[model samples]
Target: MIIEQSHFLFVSLYIFAISIGGLLLNRRNIIILLISIELMLLAINLQFVIFSVFLDDIIGQINALLILTVAAAESAIGLALLVVYYRIKGTISINKINLLHG
Candidate 1:
């Protein structure tokens, strides 16, 4: 059994669709939103890997590594902000974040 570029692209498309759906379907949950964002990043990283493999290039993999690093930092900061917000508000609902407004 051999895998092809089309198969990789198809899987990437499915992941992208699911990530978008996750982002759109749940408007109130901050955790779900963060997970969706991570999914989207993973889907993009999948594309970068696929293209790099097909093109016989190393740059795509390097860029994907950079993206992963940035995603990690983003997730850490986002979770920290979530923790602070929850400490103050006792909830992680997006609808309730307006309380941060002065």
Candidate 2:
């Protein structure tokens, strides 16, 4: 019971940190956005592993692997977008690239 509670607390704190980081740093830095996304993904992965271990099931591990693949793809796309935006705007600052009115 104690272990489960601790896991819940840890996951909650990680999610809260990710949310706060995303909200506060979205306009200030693109890297922070990436980090925040990774943090959120990590929390999900942790939860999956915990549940898998608790249930003695392998499905959670498989799901976590899938999530990791999705995260990699997401990061690749995000970085690609950032690169394109930087090429056009000459900066990677998220606040300065608001020219998406196409």
Candidate 3:
């Protein structure tokens, strides 16, 4: 039995679509936005690895590693900001973000 590259491609595309939908549709919480972004990155990484394996090329894998590193850093920074915002505002909801207008 063998799995085709298009199968993995379609799976990754589906994941990307869900993540985008989550980001666009869920606007009440900041945490969910960050999570959706992470999921999108994961989908991208999955696509990179799938293509890399299918093409027998290392460049795609390397790109995936770089993206993984960026995702980790982004998550860390995002969490730290969330913590700070929560401490000051005592809530992680995006509705209160209008306070930044000052």
Best by lDDT: 1
Q: How much does candidate 1 score in TM-score?
A: 0.94
TM-score of each: 0.94, 0.78, 0.94
lDDT of each: 0.94, 0.81, 0.93
Each model's backbone clash number: 0, 0, 0
Model 1 worst lDDT run, 10 consecutive residues: 92-101
- Model 2's C-alpha root-mean-square deviation from the true structure amounts to 2.7
Candidate 2 local accuracy as lDDT?
Answer: 0.81
| Candidates arranged by TM-score, highest first | 1, 3, 2
Superposition error at 55 for model 1 (Å) = 0.6
lDDT tens per residue, model 2, 1-102: 346746675875778687677967577788787878787887888788777888899998999999999999999999999898889889988567678758
lDDT measured at residue 30 in model 2 versus the true structure, 0 to 100: 83
Candidate scoring better on TM-score of 2 and 3:
3
Task: Assess the local accuracy of residue 7 in candidate 1 as a C-alpha lDDT between 0 and 100.
Answer: 98
- Model 1, 1-102: lDDT tens digits are 899999999999999999999999989898999999999999999999999999999999999999999999999999999999889889888787897689
Off by over 4 Å in 3: none
Model 2 clash pairs are none
